[model samples]
Target: MTKYRPSKNSDGFTIIELLIVIAVAAVFGALTAGMLANATDIYSDSLERQKFISEVRSSFFKIIREATWQKSYTSFAGSNNKKLNIYSTDGKSIDYEIRNNNDIIQNNDQVSGSNNEILTDKIEYSSSNVYYLDQQGTGIDIVSQIENVRSLKLDFQFSNDTDDLRLQSHTLPYNLRIGRAMSYHE
Candidate 1:
């Protein structure tokens, strides 16, 4: 046979074709990485929001319990509209207020042990969701006590740049409503 010569139609990839394939693979890999990073960010944000909501709910219930327990001596503190004062017979008093303009703070000087309790670190105070009663029987802004307030409404809001979670509850010396209803019935 003469010098061997290869056919042009061989069933194999050329250098240009191989290079194109590698480029396409690299593009796909980049896209996948970006997608994964975005997903992780979303998951983290969701988890933070859930934790914030849980804390708000737990704090609301805790305050309700404490307010109920102090029903006998719960009173609207005249000095601070945002604060609800509970005084025991022994002169010890506990003050509950939304401090730092948003976070709930409990000043339990009445307790021989323990200090102020921070109800929650995440509060969207600027949302205008929190409210309290004026001296009258009407609901009003927490920052302002118009008259003889009958109760306080603790409306907590937790939020991130994109989402918001809120919970609300009213505080009335536990027996106030019940006692009033009973008297009316009698």
Candidate 2:
């Protein structure tokens, strides 16, 4: 009968090796979980910022479009401060004031006789020429006093017909370009 000798090395992993492998796996799992959590947070923040910017832009354009269609009031005084004192539909009260300072103040007292409250502040514009609602419904923020503006541009389109040309002669631009560059952090 031939005698069989046992090998020095074990066929399977020892207890220590198994423990070490489990520890390494646990570490890797923890790191992966942390990275995933961080990524989720960043994505959520980006989405929120995007939504905020969209709301701001939408509100701004809506105001501009309305102002463009309405008749400008030239008889009112103290309205030349590169700010628009937009009155409510009732005509008895001011709704909000869009100022060249990039502030949107709501006149709470228009009908209630309350003072104006700032709805938004620190608005940054891309154009150096800040457009505000003048007292007369005119866009008159044409001075270079506005600082930190990244860009400013003006465009005018003329009518093709002679009758329309007369109307266009006295009219300001129907469209305005406003842009700004700034970083917003939340």
Candidate 3:
């Protein structure tokens, strides 16, 4: 009987070589997955910041408009200048309030008993300054002196978890911009 020997060159890969290839591929796959996850988180954070700014800007403009246009207010009271009840003769009323100690600001327009409102829970309330006009159109914010005054200014400080913005507003006059000179001349 004679023993046969096999050649050194083989047509297929060795078991050791196949195992190494699979291990390298798995490491690359894991790295790619991690990168993708990080990119997704960055995108989400940017979107949230954008939304926060938009809502803050829009609400600020609306509040300024109300301060300039509305001729009367039913009440103004609260710590750090929060809460305003607008005066309306049309049997409906609108109320603006900052709730929960620097957390949120809300606008509630009540037709009868229900509240129609728009609010954002993300705005961080810092502080607000309320100013009013007397019969002579002087600015005041004292509660004791409110009966003889008109609203003249609204200084609002709004914030998100990431940033802070201060919006200072001044109305034209106590008469609500009625019948004023159109041009200034030398």
Candidate 4:
């Protein structure tokens, strides 16, 4: 084997080559930064949406569960029509109300501690969120005639700043349907 020697013209690096490499690296860095920023924004939006949905859904289910065997129900008057009072046969009363124009709160007077809970801060401030329904599913004015109300429909609009979600739920008292038993999902 012959001994190999390096070429005399082979220098370490040229200024132009160094500058070109730096420019390419900078371009790649900038692109990576932009993609990272976009990903962060997407993650933030998704988290917010999930939190909003969780809050609203949990609150809704809590109300449904508590009122499943309600003996009587009433609504607040005037601008608080959306607020409700549910009473059980055991005299336990639970009140659901909107406070500060956005937050949905639950007050269980029967409980001594932890009686008050902030359900969500995404509910739209409106008096029409709760609708009292008759046996025929017709909406009724609770303030005027609440005696005929057999069920309730919750029509809430929740927001996460980036998007808005509307949820409508109609709850029929399961126990009240005595002989007309139906599946849980039905």
What are the RMSD figures for all models against the true structure? 6.1, 15.6, 7.2, 6.4
**lDDT of candidates 1 onward, in order:** 0.63, 0.42, 0.60, 0.72
User: Which one is best on lDDT?
Assistant: 4
Better of 2 and 3 by lDDT: 3
For every model shown, what is its TM-score relative to the native structure?
A: 0.60, 0.47, 0.57, 0.75
lDDT of candidate 2 over 120-186, digit per residue (tens): 4434322212234333445444343222212222211112112111101122223222322234610
Q: Report lDDT (Cα) of residue 2, candidate 2.
A: 96
The deviation in Å at residue 103 for candidate 1 is 2.7
Tell me the lDDT of candidate 1: 0.63
How many backbone clashes does every candidate have?
4, 7, 0, 0
List, residue by residue over 1-186, the lDDT tens digit for candidate 3. 888888698799999999999999999999999999999999998898788788877876666665554433324433125565554434344566666565445444545544535555544455665567665767766476655555466777777777777777766433334432245710
lDDT of 4 by residue, 70-158 (tens): 65433223313567777666767778887756988888877876466887878787633777777798988877776567777777777
Tell me the lDDT of model 2 at 167: 9
**What TM-score number comes out for model 3?**
0.57
Better of 1 and 3 by TM-score: 1
- Could you give me the TM-score of model 2 versus the true structure? 0.47
Off by over 4 Å in 1: 1-17, 73-80, 87-94, 109-113, 124-152, 157-166, 171-173, 177-186
Model 4 weakest lDDT span, ten residues long: 72-81
Q: How displaced is residue 95 in candidate 2, in Å?
A: 4.8
